[model samples]
Target chain A: DQQVKQNSPSLSVQEGRISILNCDYTNSMFDYFLWYKKYPAEGPTFLISISSIKDKNEDGRFTVFLNKSAKHLSLHIVPSQPGDSAVYFCAALVTDSWGKFQFGAGTQVVVTP
Target chain B: NAGVTQTPKFRILKIGQSMTLQCAQDMNHNYMYWYRQDPGMGLKLIYYSVGAGITDKGEVPNGYNVSRSTTEDFPLRLELAAPSQTSVYFCASSSSEAGNTEAFFGQGTRLTVV
Candidate 1:
């Protein structure tokens, strides 16, 4: 079973616009979420994260919003830059499982100039 | 900074053969992990260690063994390789004190079994 899921396989946005990536989780035990950006031939790099206690968390141009009632979370990049293009993965914390992580299939975000 | 180094960047093994993948991190993070990723699927944890001499199984721990003798190194051993084990393996480390923080991943080691 896929506890964490990013239904969208890919997304494309024009530079200077906003890019939104969404994720959902089936396990209610997950109380924290994280976003990672990956490029070809390199390991994934952490972007932003949010906790169940907070509805939103922001870091520079990146922001993460969570809705417990909907079991969903999203990452938004305002005034997206072409350099932001990469595969974005959403992950959830499985605390009961020794802090093991459950990741979504990931969405390829394309920020076109 | 050589955050996480995984040796033998690429390897090929025959079915039933055995091998070991080495991973070392300089960050001195308390948490280390091993994960595998396949096409169309996200990352799956194989094993992890909270500190030296302590290890735990992850979501996909079958057919694999791990040893953590020191905080800087965590090696994964494949006793008997299988075709299903052919995939990219990654090693990561994190400092949980940083609010259940982010993990730094290795460049990844691609393994193929015939």
Candidate 2:
């Protein structure tokens, strides 16, 4: 069963516009949520994370919002740039597991000029 | 610091063949993990170790084994290869701390099984 799901397989946005990626989870036990970005032939790099205690976390151009009651989370990048084009994976830390993480299928975001 | 390094960036194996995917980290992290990413799929944890002499299975642990004899090295072993096991494998490490759960990943190892 896929506890974490990224319904959209891919997303596209024009450069200098808003690009939002969404993720939903069925497991209520997950307390920590994270987003990672990956380029071709490279490993997934950590972007940002939000603890269950906080509803939102921001890092410069990147921001993550969590809605525990809705079981949803999102990553928003304003004024998306060409360099932002890549595969994004949403992950959650399993509560019972010892720092083990579960990831979503991923959403391929394309930022065009 | 080289961070996390994984040897054999690519490999191919026939049925019943066995090989070791070696991973080493320079961060001196006490926690290490091995995960596989199928095409168009998310990463699934195979095995992880909090420290040497300790290993545990994760979401997907079939047809795989791992040993962490040292703090810097964690090798994943495939006893018998299968087509289903063909995927990109990643090795990650992090210090065993609450605020440091963010992981550092290696370049990744692409394995193809026939």
Candidate 3:
């Protein structure tokens, strides 16, 4: 079973606009959510993260919003730039699973100029 | 500082062949993990190690083996290669400070089993 899911495989947004990527999870035991950005031929880099206790967390242009009631989380990038185009993956930490992280299928975001 | 390093960036193996993929971390992390990513699929855990001499299987551990002899090294072995095993493998490490923490990943190894 897929504990974490990102239904949208791809997304497109114009530069200077906002880019929103959504993710959902079925396991309630997950208390921490993280987002990673991956570029071609390179490893994924951590972007932002949010704990279950917080509804939102912001860092510069990146923001993560978590909703326990909906079992969902989203990454928002305001004034998106063309360099922001890449594959975004959302992962959840299974609090009881020895630090094993469950990652979503990933969403390919395209920021056009 | 080369947080995480994986050797053999690309390899091609024939069916029934066996080979080992090397991974090492200079961060002295106690937790290390091996994951494989298939086309259009999310990363799937293959194996992991909490510390030296302690290893555990992950979601997809069949046909694969791993050893954690030292905190800095974790190697994955493929007993007998299969076409289904063709995928990109990634090695990651993280500190044991908390349950929820970011992991540092290597560039990745692309393996093709023909």
TM-score of chain B of each: 0.97, 0.97, 0.97
Error (Å) of candidate 2 at residue A32 is 0.8
Task: Supply the DockQ value of model 1.
Answer: 0.67
Residues A57-85 of candidate 2: C-alpha lDDT, one tens digit per residue = 99998999999999999999988999999
What's the candidate order when arranged by decreasing DockQ?
Answer: 2, 3, 1
Candidate 3 error regions (>4 Å): none
TM-score of each: 0.94, 0.97, 0.98
Better of 1 and 2 by DockQ: 2
What is the per-residue lDDT of model 2 for residues B1-114, given as tens digits with 9 covering 90 to 100?
Answer: 799999899999998999999999999898899999999899999999999999999889999999999999999999899999999999998787767778889999999999
Give the TM-score (vs. native) of candidate 2: 0.97
Q: Per-model C-alpha lDDT, please?
A: 0.91, 0.94, 0.93
The CA lDDT at A59 in model 3 is 99
Candidates 1 and 3, the one with greater TM-score: 3
Model 1: pairs clashing at backbone N, Cα or C within 3 Å: none
Better candidate by lDDT, 1 or 3: 3
lDDT of 3 by residue, B47-86 (tens): 9998999999999999999999999999999989999999
Candidate 3 chain B lowest-lDDT run of ten = B94-103
Candidate 1 has what TM-score? 0.94
Error of 3 at A96 (Å): 4.2
